[model samples]
Target: MTLIDLTPAPAATARANALPVAIIGAGPIGLAAAARLTERDIPFVVLEKGESAGAAIREWGHTRLFSPWEHLVDDAAVRLLGASGWQAPAAGRAPSGRELVDEYVAPLSAHPAIAPHLRTGVEVLAVTREGMDRTRTAGRSRAPFALRLRLADGTIVDETASAVIDASGTWGQANPLGSGGLAPLGWDAVADRVAPALPDVLGADRERFAGRHTTVVGAGHSAANTLIALASLARDEPGTRVTWLIRNAAAARISTGGDELEGRGALGARLERLVADGRVEVLDRFEILRAEPAGDGVRLHGRRAGEAAAHDTDLVVAATGFRPDLGMLRELRLELDDIVEAPRRLAPLIDPNVHSCGTVSPHGYRELAHPEQGFFIVGMKSYGRAPTFLLKTGYEQVRSVVAWLAGDAASAGRVELTLPATGVCSTSAGGCC
Candidate 1:
């Protein structure tokens, strides 16, 4: 892929250099971009909607990551952290979400070079050219970006930047539990009974799940993690019952790489033991059609195979995955695929339908470019609805994008990434987590 011409006209380049490159979200990918910019001596600012860095990761802090420390840490971040005498975590050790934030994200955000440019509790509502919308084309590349932000204290703020990098992730926009990718009937009315995808079953949310009959929907690893946790809860509280629901005819969707995989393989093995011991009931080929309020809990109506079937449960966990939020960029020019919603050029490379190995080739500024110059959507949000995103892939994306922004065309064009191969492909034909 060819890198776009990042250098502006002589007059525009002068003006652009005076302004800071505004980055949205303070997650790992966003912070890594900041570290790269710092190394290049580029002026930039980071805006996070949450009260602190890695705010989204904190929601599922109890869950351990499938990748180890070697795959999770970015090179630029390590260089910056190493200068401050920061010790790295054990190379082979896998960290929980909380530990990742506390050890890596928090320290990176506190670095002198990055800390001064970071701003938390600031939500970017919209992004557009200073005086032009998506319709205009002339001089659009030269104009600075205008951002509409919502502050923490119920106040609105307007900010401008030479360039905008949207690293905002897709954690909050979860897929629905209903069949055909739509919300089930009476879903909102019975919303109170539904549990978050990755709840702290054995910790803070123990009371809500103990002694309750719960059904987990989805065939991804998130579902596996929740099912394992529920089994542990059932062991302690004998009254607690757990059921797993999936649309596939067989449980082969669980791809266990055996000894080939590291942290993820161990999780797959634990889930296999649970299935063998009959601790968690697996209902395959079950498609949810509707959900209705029944007594204190909810009754789920669906079809098992071709016939009709239903299940009444006290709670449901929707681990169906998430989609990117494109509402904020309506006014900005973008080229997205119809199905995956990722950048047009990137969809073909990462689409689960075309590539089912759960591994995507490395992509950089070339694949991430949009019609609007100096604007990029990176990290998990760049993958749209695809679940094949890895932290290693996201780090490579920022490294290349930042190099281009800093006028290092050759560096930006050379994209390389190394990912652990999954021996088994996903049986459901959907991207793997």
Candidate 2:
């Protein structure tokens, strides 16, 4: 790894004179904040729990973003990367998550302006107000915040900052799978008898699934991905049979960059193709009730949509989505939404009237319309219930907040670009749809 230290030549005494700003999470949003701070000449340090920029993106790096490159990349990010002579992907192309991290995020991190201040693998466990301490700024003394951080190596460090922003994204929580994400007869009954978790990508546990029938549930992107991956495996593993259960009569398509899946979007299209080949059993609008060990496999009891009678199946999977985990914030004195437990509102400008020192709203987009003060939340963790548009929203929020921090009120507002209205999938044939 190349390390370039850009700290001023002045002694440590002089270096500690500047006010600090704490930014958590180094995804696209955090990079935006760093870029804005660089342009404004603000002295700040960014803390990222991940090993590098967009670590979350790296986890699903093989997948494609639902939005086009234009929506994924922000203006501030483009400016920084441009200074280093980096060319961006074509405007409307949907890049894979890995591509977004590499071409867009990595270059921004290498920028001299933002690079020096970013400390990777540093997770912020908590942020609290420090008592007043007068410090000379220009000619008078001013108060600044004292930040507390817990690094990945279990090191605890404290520093002073004037502001804080959160770009942690939705990677923090898991959406509930309904009924504890297991068939009602109890998963333990079939736990030793079924395939392993995420088996499509990881490969089924042959001892448990060979010559066995299985069922999967849900209608979201993740569910689609798992089903498609499994279908491909079935081509060679003929002894395995698979069934897909959807609560809705039809699955919704996940669209991006003029692409659409025939069954819905790309995933829906893939599933449709799988169905055509007799590779999967499609049970639309089926609600599961229970499951139990029945001879060789498990018996899953559920009612089909509009059907008064119950039905049976061999194995079941819960593919429902996730929600924000408020366990960490339980001690903080902040308002939460009744339904999702996310912050209620956030202002673009950091005014004390809008938010307290340590909180963020659940719906991050709302923060663009009404800014929050002191506390800022970025990345997917801030997206709460809606993660489909997380990348676009996170990019905008950081740009707006950093601009306001630099005292540029004109920069805060709704994004001007219109999201692509094309079908969820197209002839372009992007994978991980």
Report lDDT per candidate.
0.83, 0.56
RMSD of 1: 3.2
lDDT of 1 by residue, 224-262 (tens): 888999999999996899999998876553567643345
Q: Candidate 2's residue-wise lDDT over 188-232, tens digit each?
A: 666664442234343334344445566776666666666776676
Measured on C-alpha atoms, candidate 1 has an lDDT of 0.83
In candidate 2, stretches whose alpha carbon ends up further than 4 angstroms from where it belongs are 1-18, 131-148, 157-160, 180-215, 253-264, 283-318, 331-335, 341-372, 413-433
Best by lDDT: 1
Candidate 2: TM-score? 0.70
